[model samples]
Target: MTAPLLEVNDLKMHFPIKSGLFSRAKTFNRAVDGVSLSIQPGETVGLVGESGCGKSTLGRCIARLYQPTEGRVYFKGNDLVHLSHKALLPYRQNIQMIFQDPMESLNARHTVGEILEEPFIIHGIGDAQSRRRSVAKLLDTVGLPSRSATRYPFEFSGGQRQRIGIARAIALNPELIICDEPVSALDVSIQSQILNLLMDLQQEYNLAYLFIAHDLAVVKHISDRVLIMYLGQIVESAASETIYQSPLHPYTQSLISAIPIPDPHRKTNRILLQGDVPSPIAPPSGCRFHTRCPVAEPRCSETAPSLLEAETQHDARCLLINSQ
Candidate 1:
């Protein structure tokens, strides 16, 4: 196999949980706690979990948009975690992020052309005339008319704004792009179009993707590898087909079972998870999923299970499954 384009090792991002009459130190929300993975060049790795599972936080950390409290982010063998803001600029062009909400991500005041041109100016891609030429090409590449470039973000519809967001991401021709629910906001019909656009772009640019989403169906469609995260930790990492066909961890099983089947006659085993995800501020001592895992044993609440490989490259954090 080829060397990974992006490797995240024990990546952690903790937001301080402060609470007091005058605001004193309390605890921390362990958003991404000891998470690790890698993304090969031109491959798509999907990060799937519930809303507060720190999927988006991890994406931002990978893109260097948020500084991780602990752990290392290596892009093409370069350690990004230790790099200062000034030093991180070179990697910014190769790693871009598409936010979940197109409206919030794009500045309402800036025109489409201005938004796309910002990266060129920041990275010093070209002077006035050349940058202008790049802007027009980007607008057309995203399937938007060049005339739309002069219009503000508010004037465009949701899908159109998302297209603009995608154009900006590719303006630098990034080697890796972290997509934080890129198509979740749009209607179902528009979702497929955006997904197709992303697949096409990946093939055209040989780009890698760290796709963060809660929707398993969408992830299964785009991801070559899938990581199942829970309570800020990855419980399962395997090929997309393996994870969907034979999930190992209880959390993974439940998540897989939750995916709706298109066929009316197809009856599947539903592993419904009980209880809500534990508070990250005070995560369970050993296995964070023990609180809700139906197959959880006493050892689950006492000793944590490390992610161990099964057949080939598949891995999961579960004692019962691994022992089998």
Candidate 2:
């Protein structure tokens, strides 16, 4: 069996929230309580969940953009959580991240060429002449004209800017790319273009992607495996087709049911979740999803369910599923 290209075990990211000015009383927002997943070389794993479900935080932790509060992030068997700046530099080239909003991520002061060239500069991969040539080639690879290298991010459309972001991410020939909702801001038509471009790049470079998004439809189209995340934890995980066809966790079922069908005449059963997502600073006891889970039992409020394998290559964190 091929070894995993990236592995995250019991990852957590907590931010302190201080209320009193001088009291020194602080509480931590448990953004990502405990997440454990792995990605093989040349694979795409889609992480689907509602906004503020800690999906982005988890991605940043894996990319080492945000130092995790707890747990191990192993890339090619080396833990990244505790690596020093100099020691982590080499691994930075192997793992990269594409933010949700290209406009915000790209530097406004720099031209597109400069933005794309920054990666090679930081990694000491090439000289000025070679980097310039590489930058132009990257623009062409992402379906942009070579001339785009001279332009600023604001001068281009949203899709074009995203293309630039993609170009920057691939500049280092990374083994794993954490795509944080890369298409949620683009139009439907443009979103397809970007998604297809990513797929093509994956095949060309054998790249592995941790694709994060709220759209199940988008996830279904690009992902081989899908993980369903709730408040601050993953409730279920399985192959894209298997989870969509038969979601085990109630949260997964609700999310899957909400995907819009193109056929207007076909009847759809939408599971409307009651109540807003609870505060992550103080999430509900036991099953973090029980507050909004449709079929939650009384015991769900007391016993925190463990992520257990319910079948081959399928896992869920639901007491009901475990009881059966």
Candidate 3:
């Protein structure tokens, strides 16, 4: 059997928050506490969670955009966590990122052609003429017209700009792409088009994806597996079908139940939590989800639950569920 293209082990990213004029005291916002997962070649792993749940931070860490606070990010047997910038250059070509806001990510000054060609230029892939040709192909690949390449980002609509971002990300033919809410900012109609484009590109290039999004329905459609995160930690990880069908974690169950049903005639039970997600800087004492978990037991508040396999190959971080 082939090995995974990416392996994240006990990964954490903590941003220090300074206080006071002298900044004598400092606190760390534990954006990502301990996230561990593996992604095989050409597989899509959907990361779903609420806002500020560290999904984007985790994606950035995997992309090596942010140096990890602790743990290892192994890609093809090498730990990327401590690799120097120069040392990591070669691996950069094998991994890429598509940020949530295309308007912010894309260079407003540069033409679409220039933007797409930047990756090849950075890696010194092909000469000027060849790079231009590659840029044209990338435009075509992302469903943008060749003429659009000469236009600046501001000239395009939100969806069009996102397509441009997608075009640029695949320009280097990276083995893995970290897509952080790539379609969330676009219209619902446009979101489908973008998702379809990504799937088509994945099939064409044999690409692997770390798809981060808040929309469970979208994740369900595109992902082979799903990872549910809360309070800077993964609460559950399982196959997409299994995660939706038999969610053991109360947090995961609540999230699934919240996905709107299309049929008005059908009745469904929605699991509503009591309060907001606790601040990651000072999270709950025991299970991070215990404060909001509807099915949380008395033991949940006193004892932290490690991520344990509740069923075959399916893991959840819940004492109540794991005990049963």
Candidate 4:
């Protein structure tokens, strides 16, 4: 079997909060408690969770944008956690990120041409004239007009700006792209277009993607494998079809039930979770999800459950599933 292109083991990202008069007393916000997963070459893994579940934080940690507080991030068997900024340059070329808001991610001062050429310039890929030619080619590749190379980002629509962002991400021919809710800020129609563009790009480049989003339907449409996260931890993981058809964890069931059906005539029951998500700064003991789980028993509050294999290639973290 082919080895994974990227592997993350027990990664954590915690931000410290200080409140004393001297600001000496500190509490850590456990944004990413412990997440472990892998992505094969050219595969797309979907990470689905509600808002404030640390999905974006986890993605940033893997991309080395935010140095993780603990654990290991291995890319091609190289541990990235300990690499300094100067030492990480070579690896940065192979991993790129697409932010959710295109305008914010793009520089207002730079024209499209300059933005696209920046990567080549940083890596010393080509001369001035050659970089310009490459920039024009990138514009065409993303379906933007050559004239767009001279235009500012504010001149284009939201979808067009996103296309430029995608162009920049692919400029270095990255093997892995961390897509942080790339389509969440666009119109519904535009969302499909961007998603299709991303899929096409992946096929053309054999790129692997860690697709992070809150929309279950969007995840189902694009993912080969799906991971359900709650309170900064993965609750269930399996093939996309298996996750949609037969989810094992109560948290996954509630999330799956929330996906809207396209057919108006078809009716489905919704599994409504109780209580709000607890603060990550002080997450509940035992199962982090037990507070909102409808079927949670007393045992759930007393003992945490490890992620256990429920079937071939399927894993879930729940005491009920563990008992079976």
Q: How many clashing pairs does model 3 include?
A: 0
Local accuracy of candidate 1 as per-residue lDDT tens digits, 1-324:
788899999999999877766796678999999999999999999999998999989998888788999999989899999999999999998999898889999999998889989999999878989998999999888889999979999998889899999999999999999999999999999899899999999999999999999999999999999999998999999999998888878898888887789999999889888878888889998788888998888988988888899667899888787778
lDDT of 3 at 21: 77
Least accurate stretch of 10 residues (summed lDDT) in model 4?
17-26
Evaluated against the true structure, the overall lDDT of model 4 is 0.93
Tens-place lDDT digits, model 2, residues 1-324: 688999999999998887877766378999999999999999999999888899999999988889999999999999999999899999999999998899999999999999999999888888999999999899999999999888899999999999999999999999999999999999999999999999999999999999999999999899999999988799899999999888899888887787779998987899999989899989999999989989999999999999999988999999999999
Instruction: Show the colliding residue pairs in model 3.
Output: none
Regions more than 4 Å wrong, model 1: 21-24
Worst 10 residues of 2 by lDDT: 17-26
lDDT of 2 at 185: 98
Candidate 1's clash total is 0
Q: Write the per-residue lDDT of candidate 4 for residues 210-266, one digit (tens) a residue.
A: 999999999889999999998889999999999999999999999888778899998
Give a tens-digit lDDT track for model 3, residues 95-208.
999989999999899999899989998888989999999999999999999999899999999999999999988999899999999999999899999999999999999999
**Which scores higher on lDDT, 1 or 4?**
4
Question: Candidate 4, residue 94: CA error in Å?
Answer: 0.7
* Candidate 3 positional error at 29, Å: 0.7
RMSD for each of the candidates: 1.3, 1.0, 1.0, 1.0
TM-score of every candidate relative to the true structure:
0.97, 0.98, 0.98, 0.98
Question: Residue 28 CA error for candidate 4 (Å)?
Answer: 0.8
